[model samples]
Target: MKPLHRLLALALAVSMPGGVALAADLRVMTSGGFTAAYQRLGPQFAAASDNTLSTVLGPSMGKAPQAIPNRLQRGEPADVVIMVGYALDELIRQGKVAADSRVELADSRIGLVVRAGEPKPDISTTAALKKTLLAARSVAYSDSASGVYVERQLFEKLGIQAQLAPRGTMIERIPVASVVAKGDYQVGLQQVAELLPVPGVTFAGKLPEDVQSVTRFAAGIPTGAQHPAEARQLLDYLASPQVQGTVQATGLDSVPR
Candidate 1:
């Protein structure tokens, strides 16, 4: 019975629970805009919960509209997802995420940036902002949600669509701040949170009052998440008051609700 005893020992070893080898790994899929916040919080979450977080940073292109849905349809594994509130709601309706697991984290507003030491231009009103855009040699913006909104709706509303069409450029994958830093464009426009992180660029300010658009960011657990409890804990930590200050310092507003 020596061989049978050996087989039982192997089974015991493999089936053992509460071991480091068997610890849960929470896989998270997030947009590039949240990179800085996650970099700070991921390690804290791991240390507090004794669970591992594996993050996948996706491009900002259609962050809410297309990229997320495409990734879910492609069968990407994600225990948790962090993105715009409207997008998360859509995913909930599509049955990709747990409807009850949603939690609002922060709010981001669109802003402009110019190379450090450059003279800051006025964009305090719709008319003034339009003039600034027209006067710029070449403007750079993202290919993501904010950029799309600006290009499709705001510019047309401002009556300068024709002027920017020929010379303006939309950057994808890379941050708009980088484009401004390289002198490829006279000004960069993106979420305030995104523009603040890149070096060599100084924030001008958020868009004017009437035209300003704020995107609410949130986190949700996938419906079939293997570590739902751990995911909830991480979400709680992110939305806590302690984390909210960091969120605000990054140019995002604290979620009011």
Candidate 2:
């Protein structure tokens, strides 16, 4: 997305009213990865539409009570869900979300984090990354999309599953970087956006492209939404080109044009 196009997106969003005559209250459930950027842009959308957003934070998929799917299953009301694309697809498949409302917001790639002032390890290449993993005393990854990929796929690809198994920890309900920050882990692996915002951590860099897991962050209107009109408008504001800069600034890649 380019600046001119983003401006046009903003212009169209401002001109269009999706049918709500006045401000609306929307209940939104969001997961990690996109949370930082959403917090930054949520206010902008509210200012543009005078709509109020009530937000709940959770993972896209997990057994935890705060997980979006679990929250919905427990009868929580939600007008919108911002989470992993595949997780949203599952909701649509189950008829919990409107199929036509899916929209890709951004892509987040896994990155490495070390406690602030710690030696940043070399994970700039596949071989280097494998070596770094082998050398680490403790490794932490989230229990979300990126971590799942690393746990079930990435280590298998590197042929170090058994060796790294004991060393790697699947951190749940909190940022993986938090453990690294506390010196509980030597290395943290998670989405760049999730890692960058945590203090006392130094981001080494993204995993080498071939070994990376790119999780697509997306948004959709859930079934039985109280404010469907406002939810769609809010989605438009989020995916608009106007916010691409902020998206990148938060360590996310804009969805493909």
Regions of candidate 2 where Cα sits further than 4 Å from its true position: 1-21
Output the lDDT of residue 199, model 1: 96
Question: For residues 5-45, what per-residue lDDT tens digits would candidate 2 score against the true structure?
Answer: 45544554565567334678889999999999999988777
lDDT of 1 by residue, 137-157 (tens): 988888776787788877888
Candidate 2 — which pairs collide?
A: none
lDDT of 1 at 257: 61
> How accurate locally, in lDDT, is each candidate?
0.78, 0.90
- Alpha-carbon RMSD to native, per candidate: 9.2, 3.1
Question: lDDT score, residue 116, model 1?
Answer: 85
lDDT of 1 at 57: 69
Task: Give the top-scoring candidate (TM-score).
Answer: 2
